[model samples]
Target: MNISTIGIIGAGNLGTKIGLQAAISGYQVNMYDVNDKILARSLKSMEKLLVHLTRTQQLTGDEGKQSLERIFFTEYLNLALQDVDLISESVIEDLEIKTKVWQEIGEIAPAHTIFTTNTSYLLPSQFAEISGRPEKFCAFHFHDVFYSKVVDIMPHPGTSSEVITILEKLGRKLKQVPILVKKEHSGYIFNTLLIAWIDAAGRLVTGEIAEVEAIDKSWMINFGMTAGPFGILDNVGLDTAWHITSTKRNPASRAFAALLKSYLDQGKLGVKSGEGFYTYPKPSYKDPDFLK
Candidate 1:
């Protein structure tokens, strides 16, 4: 299928990035959220990203301007789905919420539109049937689109082979490296390793084995990485990390979830809210003295 226009069914961080990238790739984009406030935030985020792209020479000023011009932000589901060739759902990572959103999209989206989910850990089969078009649904999960450029094309048992091929092409169009997950697996590949690493970081903190900076410093200096597990969790959003971690049945996961909950209670949602394990725009992990 030739995809011309893309519909983004959520306007959160990842959704905003996807929508912006789609527009940059010369696809008309409709970004949908539940409220005007959320839509406004999504637009603002795109604008900020465009500025960074332009400043870094990744996108010319005119290209950035044109990308924004190609994007339409809306609160109405029907408006966003109207004439869209594909729908990428990036709603909250909750089964019930995702099912509910998919059902609504299945009701209103164009019959020919392909359906995909950007779920972090959830399987596509969990919502494929709920979407009312099992064969048309698959998981097209993207990590950080610009930095982490891998997109996972994971199909449920009912997904069509044609849809898989189309998504592979589309992923490359969006300048991503597409990897096909042969089977249904929670957390895909990178995230599977990531979760174990993050779990260890959480255990160290909650078990009082080490402090957050100490844990992060140990990993960053050892691996020559820009950010450690805690630093990454902050960028991923503490709430999102908490949501994923809270699902694990292990004692260490539960303890980490509780710690995340405390941060959430304080209204500190990591970089988005300007504070998490450390302050943002100047996180200590980014400091030269941090590893020292």
Candidate 2:
């Protein structure tokens, strides 16, 4: 299918990035959220991102303006789905919430519109039947679109070959390297590796093995990495890490989830909330002397 118009279901962080990238790629985008405030925030985020992209010379001033013009924000689901060639759901990672959102989209979205989920760890098969179009459904997971350019194309047993082909082409058009996950593995590839690394960091903190900064410095100095697990978790949103970590039954994961929950309760959701493992806009890791 020639995807021209894309509907983004969820105007949160990742969803907003996806919609903006689609618009920049010359695809008309409809970004949807249940709350008006969230929709408004998403637009502001896009505007800020455009400024950065323009200043960095990644996009021309006129191109950034055109990209914003191509995006339409709406709170109404049906309106967003109207005439859209594809729907990418980036709703909360909860199965129940995602299932409910997919069910609604399945009912209202055009029959020809392809359904894709931006779920991080969840499998596409979990919602395929609920969407009422198993063959047309797949997981089109993305990392940080601008920085981390890989897009994972994961399809369930029922997904069609044609859908996979279309997504591969679409991923490239969006300027993302496409990776195929042959089976339904939770957390896909990078994330699976990330979880283990994060679990270790969390253990060090929760177990009082080391301070957050020490752990981060250890990884950064040795690996030449800019950020460590805790720093990365901050960018991922402490609440999101809690959600994913809470699902694990292991003792270490449970303890880590509890630590994350404490941060969430304090309203520290990482970069978006202005604080997490460290304060942002000028996080400690960014300090020139951090490693020293």
Candidate 3:
């Protein structure tokens, strides 16, 4: 089915980014969350970002205004689901919470609304049965900054070929480079590679092989890359990094986890909180001479 209106079932980092991009790309975006305060903050943040983009000449003033107008935020599930052709669920990553969110969407959303999840670890298969339309269920995962513009479309054995085709086209409409995942994989291609690389970088720091700045400078200069692992982690958010690394506790892993925990405890949860492995809005990595 052709998707024009999108129902985003969470207003957190990933969902807000997706909604913002969808709106900017001219889709009618309904972004829903259970918390009114959080939804307000997200909308406010989106507005700020639009003005920033306009100021930077990345978006025309009229275009940014229209994009903001296209997004509708709500706490009511039914309101968000109304007339939506596709529902992208971005609830908490816990299996139970996701299953509950999908189940509710399955019950209330339009029958024609195809379901997708932005889950990082859980498989689409795990939530398919609860979705009430297993054949129409798949993974439509986007990066933290949807403006990076790459999306992973993963279909399980039970998903209909038709659903996958619809999503691939929808991804393009959202201005994303859609990558079809041929099999069921936990992290898809981009995430699996990214998580490993970041984890290894953390290990280097925890093992005392290098300071965070030194390691970042080395990686950027050697690879001629824009951002290094710590900077990337800041964008990914420290809470997520801590959660991903918490399961391991070897000497190196323990040290890394503790460092992340300290940041989390202090509410310095990365780019969102203005601090992490580095401070943001102008981290040292962004300095022109840092790589030198």
List clash counts for every candidate, in order. Answer: 0, 0, 0
The C-alpha lDDT values of all candidates are 0.94, 0.94, 0.88
Model 2, residue 47: C-alpha shift (Å): 1.7
- Top TM-score hit: 2
Report residue 281 deviation for candidate 2 (angstroms): 5.8
Candidate 1 Cα errors over 4 Å, as ranges: 259-276, 279-284
Q: What digit string (tens of lDDT, one per residue) describes model 1 on residues 39-90?
A: 9999999889989999999999999999999999899999999999999999
TM-score of 3: 0.87
The pairs that clash in candidate 1 are none
- Tens digit per residue, CA lDDT, model 3, 1-292: 5678998898987888888888998899999999899899889888888888788897899998899899999999999999999988888889888988888899998889899999888999998998899999999999755457789999999999999999888888877899999999999998889978988898898788889998888889999998899988898899988898887767767788898998899999989998887887889999998977
Tens digit of per-residue lDDT, candidate 2, span 1-292: 6899999999998999999999999999999999899999999999999999999999999999999999998989999999999999999888999999999999999999999999987899999999999999999999989989999999999999999999999999999999999888999999999988999999999999999999999999999998999999998889878888998998999999999999999999999999999997899998989988
The weakest ten consecutive residues by lDDT in model 3 span: 142-151
Estimated TM-score per prediction?
Answer: 0.87, 0.88, 0.87
Question: Which regions of candidate 3 deviate over 4 angstroms?
Answer: 249-252, 262-268, 271-275, 279-284
Best by lDDT: 2
Better model by TM-score: candidate 2 vs candidate 3: 2
